[model samples]
Every structure is written in C-alpha cells, then in structure tokens.
Target: MGKITGFMEFRRLSEQSSPVVERLKNYQEFMPRLNDQEASIQGSRCMDCGIPFCTTGCPVNNIIPDWNDLIYRNQWKSALDVLHSTNNFPEFTGRICPAPCEAACTLNINDDAVGIKSIEHAIIDKGWEEGWVKPQPARTKTGKRVAIVGSGPAGLACAQQLARIGHDVVVFEKNDRIGGLLRYGIPDFKLEKSHIDRRIDQMRAEGVEFLVGQDIGLHVPPQKLQDEFDAVVLAGGAEQPRDLPVPGRNLDGVHFAMDFLPQQNRVVAGDVLSEQIKATGKHVVVIGGGDTGSDCVGTSNRQGAISVTQFEVMSRPPEQENKSMVWPYWPMKLRTSSSHEEGCQRDWAVATKELIGKNGKVEKLRAVRVEWKDGKMHEIAGSEFEIKADLVLLAMGFVSPVQKILDAFSIEKDGRGNARAATDGAGYYQTSVGKIFAAGDMRRGQSLVVWAIREGRQAARAVDEYLMGSSSLPL
Candidate 1:
C-alpha cells in the first residue's frame, strides 16, 4: 500500500504535452515526464485493493500496486525491478500502451484512477538515467539454437527471454533495421526510434544475433531455418492492410496508412525516400478513426497539410462513459488522442463511397451519412455528399500476415488467415510443423503492443519448456 488515505486526497495527474501549434511543427514526442516528487505523490494515490483488477486488465499482468508503493517510498530502483519483473519492455508500454490498467482500477469506480502509466514512465526513465538498464548475459549456455522471424515487440521480447536462458537466438528481419513495426509501422513522433536501437544493442550484448535484411521464406527459405536451428518462432506482424475497394481507389494520392507512416519514419531516421508520400499543402482525408488514422492526421499536420479530416464508419460514442455500468472495465467512450487535439475535423457514422479523381490523381471523395438500426447500417436519405480531397490515406487496420511468407513455410492458417496455434496447454504456440511455433500478430491477429509482448513472453516460456523437458520461466 502507498498512503492510507492518499487516494481520497490526490487526483490523477496526466503527462503534460506542448501546445498544438508548436508540437505540430515537427515530429517529436511532446509529453514531458513527471518529476520524482510528483510521481511519488501520484503513486501514493494507489488504493492497493485486495484484488488488483489493473493486473488482470493489463495484458502482461503488471504488478501495479507493489511498484506504486515502491515509488511512493522513494525506492526508484526497486520500482524498476518490480516493473521489469513482468514487462520485458516497460519503456515501450510506458509510451505507446493505451493503459487499460487505469480503466480497471478500483478507484476509477468513484474517483480518478491512479496514474499507473505516468509512474511507469517516470520509473523507466529514471532507470535509464541511472544506468540501471543493462544487458544480463546468462551465466551458462543451454546451447539450443532458435530462429525467430520478425523483429517487432513480440520477437524482441521472446529473444531477450530465451537469450537470458542461454539459448542461441538469431532473429531475422525483412527490413534493414531490427525493429519490424516499432521501427517502421509506428510514427516517430509517438515513439522515437532510438529506444528500439538501444534495446537492439542490449540484446546483441546479451548474445542474441540479429540478421537484418534477412527475410525468412523470401531471401532465405524456411527449410534452411528448419535445418539450421533447433526451433523457429514466427513473430512477424499482420501487414496486409485492408483496402478500400471503391472507384478510383488506384488513383495517385491514395495510399495505405502503413505506407505513408513508414515513409515519414524512415525520413525521420535520416533515410531519403525514393517514393515518399507527402501531405504538404494537400487536403488530406483519413479513413478509419483508430490509432492509425489518428497517426495519419498527426503526420499530415506535421508535413504542412492544408487541411485534415477523419472519417469513422461507426456511430459516435458518448463523450464520457456511464461508469456506474462499465466501471473496472474498458468502456465505450469517445477517445480524443493528442493528434486529434492538434486540429482536424472528425466525423462519425460516415462511410466513404468512392474516390473521385481526375487526371490520374485523387481530387475529391464521395461519402454518405449512414444510420444504424437493428444491427445494420444503411445510408440516410439524401445524405450523400462530396468533399475536396487531394490525398486519402486508408488506416483501416491490417487483415493478416503477408501470405507470401506463410505460403513459403507451408504454415497452416486459421479462418482469419492468422497462423493456427493454441495459446494454452503443454505445447502451446506449436504450429502444424513440429519445430516451428507462432506468436503475436502472426498467431493472434492485430492487437495492442502490450498483448504482443505478453504473447512473446508466454511463447518463449512454451518454447523453453519444449526445448528442455520443462521451463522455469514465468507464464
């Protein structure tokens, strides 16, 4: 427990961000970390309930209250230890995770929830500043070789755990860089690339070999990995972005969110793009109003777009949740991200009908206001309209992992096209092929970064158990 009555005394304090005008000028993280005293006070607000719903709500099952108590006592290093005990990358989750743990807090029933994510950000930042983060090389080697495809959070987490257990781990990434999505998929403003780079260095120091530009089942065949390594873990993400199959969809200025976002990320990382999709001075229309769509809005604003607009197919959610009914769970409420705060007109229950273009380029978009009734959505009478649009970025999430690689390995896929693998029991994560296993988006489809980390850790434990008769790694 932190302070006995602190929950009643303190209110939640979120991380502060720069003003819209200033932050939109460049693609950089604007949220400032809390000071030690402020973080301690926030931590003290923890009620330390008997059953921590935050732990269950969090995908990785973080030990929330203990770390909060540790921070309240000014035990920064101890707080870091407790955080690292469960989460392999608290730093990543600290920045990008949506913090479902906060929604599930008992205090959120009647009062503001404890600033768990803010405290985590402060703890991990302090750990790095104090040089507490370092490579933990295994004392002995188990001599089992593992081949991991993909360098995203899941693969990275799995590799780190296996390396600590003395496995000969080698990760293969298609991109020139180590981090798959973290390095490319996510925009740099939300998450800087240096974080991934430093972690890659730490893993390298821990004896994990990373081979970039080595795409498994492409440049190198899956059969080679089967022959060379004791086991293989597929952690590649679902890259097949859902397309908007409308008229003039093939026109110039129409692009995928992943395509546009990654180009800017590469540019931020000092790579000059050959076919960069820029929103500079263009009237940008973003499709799909999730994190990816929000990201497009942010990026377009940064790139000096004339105007930005977002569209969501679903009906608008309530500004605030009815906490009486949805307390201790993620509720259906309106979420306005920092990107949204910058400036953009947002519309709900509007569906894009067609991309109206001329001269082989998009010039406008045709859409219609829709009504939802009896579980079906239909267009409202005479609600069809058109809007000026120079660019359209589809952020409608991913459908499945790239089928080319899956087919190359002859891996069996579920109905949803994700790799078919169970998440429980003695031989979980094992694919149809005996030596091969799958985890993260490749197995479970698109999900939060925290869920990917959890799957990676669990898959690592499963792999460890499979390799050595049993595993002592945490579930």
Candidate 2:
C-alpha cells in the first residue's frame, strides 16, 4: 500500500481505442497503450487486497499487486520484471486476454476494478522501448536434446524455459511461419505478427532452434525423434474446427472460419492467393457468436462484404453478471467486441435449419428462433425466417488436436480426443509413449493463450525434473 488510500482516491481508466470508421480502413492495431501518467493512476487504484484474488483469477498467476505498486511509483523497469516473472509473454495476454483478473479484483465488488491489463500493456511497451527485454542463455550445457512439436504459445513457452535451463531445444512448426495461431489464426488488427517475430529472434539468440514447414507425422517420422532426442513435448494445439453439416454443406460458398481467417492473414503477410475465398460484394453470415465468429465479422467488413450478420445458438447473456454468485471467477455475460462495434447485426437464440443454395453455391439460410427451458432448447412455433448470405462461415470452435500425429506416436487419448497426460504426481505430462510429453491444447483441448502459456511453463518444469530428478524452473 504505497499511498494508503490510493484505491479510494483514484478511479479506473480504460485503454483508448481509435474511432471505428478510421480503424476499419486497414488491418492494424488500433488501441493505443495508456500514457505514463494515466497508467500510474490506474495502478494506484489497486486495493492491494489481503488475498489478491486478481492473481488467482489470472491463469498465469501474475504478481499483480507488486507490479501495480511498482508502476504507481513509476519504477517501470522493476514493474516489467515483476510482470514477466510469471508470464513469459505479457504482450500477447495484454492484447487478447479477456482480463478475468479485473473481474476478480477486490475493488470490483462495488466499484470499477483496477486496470491491470492496461498497466501490464504499458509496462511491456516501455520495456521494449527502453531495450530492457532480452534472452537469458543457459550457464552450463545439459547435453540433452528436447523436441517441441508446435510453435504456439505453449510450445514456445516450454521451449524457452528448457533452453534457459541448459537443454538443447528444437521447435518444429508445420506452417511456413513460427507462430501457430498468433501468426495465422488471429487477425493482425488485434495482434500484429511482428510481436511474434521479435520473440522468435530472442529465442534464437537463447540457443533455441526453430525448423518451420515440418509436419511431424506427415513430413518427419515420429520414430526419428524418439530415437534421436532424449525427450519430446507434444504442444500441437487444437486445430480441428467444428463442422455444421446441413443439407447444402457442400455448397461452394460455405467454409470454416479458420479457412477464411487464415487466407486474409496470408494476404496481409504479402502473399498472393489464387484460390482465396473473398467476401467481396457478398452478404456474409457468421455462425456461433464467439471470438472466432466476431473475427469473421471484422474480416468480412474489411473485405467489402455487402452486409454482415451473426447468429448464436444460445440465448443472449446478461449485460452484467450477478457478482455475488460468480465473484472471483469468470462469469457469463454479454461481450461486444470491437469488431462487432464496426458494424454487425447480432441475433441470439437462433437455430440454423438448413442452407438454401442455388447452382451448388450458397445464397441464403433458413433458420428459426428458439427458446430455452430447463436448459433444453425448443424452436418457437411459426418463427422460421430466411436470411440472405453468399458466404457462410462456421466459427463455433475447435474440437481437438490433429489425430494423425498423436496416433503416429501411439499416444493414448482422453475421451475428448486430446492426448492423455497427468498434470501432477509422477508421470506428469507424460503420454503413453515412453519419453513423450503432451501440453497445452494437445492435452487440455481448446483454451486461451494464457492457459496455454501456463501449461507450457509447468510442462517444462515437469520435463526438467524428469530429466535431472529436480528443477529450478517455476511452476
């Protein structure tokens, strides 16, 4: 408590974003980080609660209070260190995380929570501007090689930790780039690929080798890794998209969200496309109103879609949650993303009946309004309607990691199709295959990047202990 009554004296300040019309003009980051004075005030709003529920709420378990105080005092270098102590990459989480940490803050009981995310964002931005962020190479060599299959957050975090602790780490990415979802899945407007590229440069300096365009099972045999490397970490994330099988599912205009989103990302990366799917002059309809669906809406608008509409199977959530019931935990509530604000027609509690197409190309969709009773959905009588849609994007979510790679190693899978592995007690992160480990979405299913980083760091610790009978790596 640097200023004893700072929480009572200061009000929370949110990050500022550019006007919708201006930002929609191009694919670039629009939110400007909080200035120094504004960040210090936001940091002062921290209650410094006895329990500090914000840390419990954050998946990475950041030491929030310590960093807040450091930022309030304008000691940014120290604040950045405290922020990075737990989280390997604050920049990614600062930009994309939903910030459950704020919802669980002590001040959020009756007042606005401290701006922890924006403060973190400011700290990291300053760290980079001042050239404070750098790589830490191992002091001694372990002479043991570890192979990580995936360039997503989980694999990257795990490899970084192992590399710092004297293990020879090699990251194999199936795509032409190093970042898995960060490079392709997410839109550049939210997180530009340069952040990932810079981190890759740092990792390279720390002695981690990256081999792109190598599909483990298809391009390289799994046995070769088992025979050559001392250990392997399977961090291949959940890549299977959920399908909407309707009467006109095979229509030429229908595609998965991943298929559409990645194509646009490639174009932004200066790649010329021949078979690219475009929303130009088309009426776009995005199914399943999650982050993926919202992303589709933004991309379609930028691609010059005539109109964009989003549909959700579930009923609309409450504008505000009942904090009494869900305090200190993530609650269900209506979330309107910046993309939605750009321009979108949102409808909830709707069910897709079938796709109505012409000449094998989707032109419209048939749907009905539904009501939920006792957790079961029932279509309303005479509530059928048709919506014009030339492009239909399935953005419901992912199911599991690619099964072929797992099967190649003969790894046991859970009921959810994710690799079966324990999180604690002996055999932690170890798969059915000897000397093989699984982490992140490969073991846990689809999740947030913060959780992926957590799993990766913990998995690295487990692997280190397994190799040397102990580890200094933080959990």
lDDT top scorer: 2
The global Cα lDDT (0 to 1) of model 1 is 0.92
Question: Per-residue lDDT of 232-334 in model 1, one digit per residue for the tens?
Answer: 9999998999999999899999999998998999899899877889999999999998999999999999999999999999999999899889878889899
Give lDDT tens digits, candidate 2, residues 1-475: 6766888898788888999889888999999799999998888888757999999999989999999998889999999999989998899999988898998998888888899999999999889999999988999999999999999999999999999999999999999999999889899999999989999999999999999999998899999999989999999889999999878888989999999999999999999999899998999999999999999999998888999999999999999999889998888999999999999999999989999898999999999999999999999999999999999999999999999999999999999999999998897999998899999999999999999999999999988988888999998
Error of 2 at 460 (Å): 0.4
Could you tell me every candidate's TM-score relative to the true structure?
A: 0.99, 0.99
Give the per-residue Cα lDDT of candidate 2 at 424.
Answer: 89
The regions of model 2 sitting more than 4 angstroms off are none
